[model samples]
Target: MIFSRITEVLTHVGVITLLILLAVTLVYYPEFRLVVFLTFIMVITLTVYISRRAARKPPKLFDVIADEVRRGSILFEVDDDEVSRLLEKDFTLYEEFRKQSYKALLESVIIVPIFLWYFIYFYLILPRFVITDLNLRLIAYIIGFVVPYILYLASELVFRVKTLTYVLRGYEVYDRGIVSSSQYIVIKFPLSKDYLVREYSNRKCVELSRKHGRYTVRFLLYTKNTPKLTETLSNYGKAEVISS
Candidate 1:
């Protein structure tokens, strides 16, 4: 009993000491990191509080994935009204939206810090280094711009699960399956159509794949004509389950 109490007291003391040190650092240097740290804590606290406040949230996942896949997987076409109906026809829409929101949160959490780091290095510290090192200025600027670009790309690539292209205009999801997935990549789109295209930007046929473990999704963006859209595939997602 005495040992347990001592251990508990020590743990509390250690945590308090660490927090005090962190507060001191923040007070000394009110930098981006400190602000980001505080922001992250607020977000985490909000997420936990909101999640805990609600109970019996219902089975909303399967419905969403199913509806989105079905709506977006069609090869033919759909009108705006029909699309609305499809989206609202079932409970899946709500769940799919939740899924999207979750994806957004994951992205936001990741991006906030990377952006802070960029601000610190480029806007804050890099100038000091470059002022003394004439040879390093060009490289520094290049690296500064490129590093953030890379981080932005990486964050998007990592968290782009809902990155779907409005291919086939109004076509719907006939089927879906896991073509492939990974940390930096994920491809998921309608399996019914052979090709999905985004015409507004350019003409390209992009194969879609959901990201691994629900982090992000990736679709191969390419261009092709309607005649080539005849090809088809079986089984969109692995172990395809019927959702609400």
Candidate 2:
């Protein structure tokens, strides 16, 4: 865990350093800005493309659940039979959710905007601004402000959609508790804790209280066996069904 945190910190530092260098180059060496800009765009585009492609291919279900169990520090014993049963029931559904989530993230939030910014700035705005026409320069400035604002809104909308989809469909029940995944984020709520299980309409949700506060979370997919699941959860804490 320490190594992982250190690696994350180093990665952030590297990215910030690169951004500062790129900015300095743009300011002091205008002649090379186009080359640098194109290179950066190409790198981002390729990285996003590769990442999306890789995310579409999920690992074996047993491996995924095993990794999560270890990461969550789950104390209850889980054998191969239990793991296989869980996988047998939810593997296909989990795969489908993952694909949709990652696709939404890549196209709506990452790759499309990179290409859009490249086209808008490099091909359109930059060339016009270079001519030094007052009216055209004003238009360029307006576009510079507006485009990113619009992209920000779009990105947020897509992020919310992806987040909701992930939260609703992606969770697994183990002997200890429930494990959920959202893209790279994983959260586990052990049944031994202060928790509540509630059902509304077709959805079943869990609320876990931590040092910070209570978090009410809904599962990503609906199951017909919600009553059974709720009964199992009640063994750990308060569990009930609520009217819609």
Highest-scoring model, lDDT: 2
Candidate 2 CA-lDDT value = 0.46
Off by over 4 Å in 1: 1-96, 106-115, 127-131, 161-244
State in Å the error of residue 134, model 1: 2.3
Per-residue lDDT tens digits of candidate 1, residues 1-244? 3554475456445543443444344434547546745653564345434332221122121223333344444443323444344444435335766887887677657656755775697568965652544345545544543455355545655555534322222333244422111212222443323232222112223334343232233333222332223233323332222111
User: Global lDDT of each model?
Assistant: 0.41, 0.46
The C-alpha stretches of model 2 lying farther than 4 A from their native spots are: 1-17, 30-34, 46-110, 130-190, 200-229, 235-244
**Error in Å for residue 186 of model 2:** 14
RMSD of each: 18.5, 9.1
Give candidate 1's TM-score: 0.29
The true-versus-predicted C-alpha distance at residue 30 of model 1, in Å, is 26
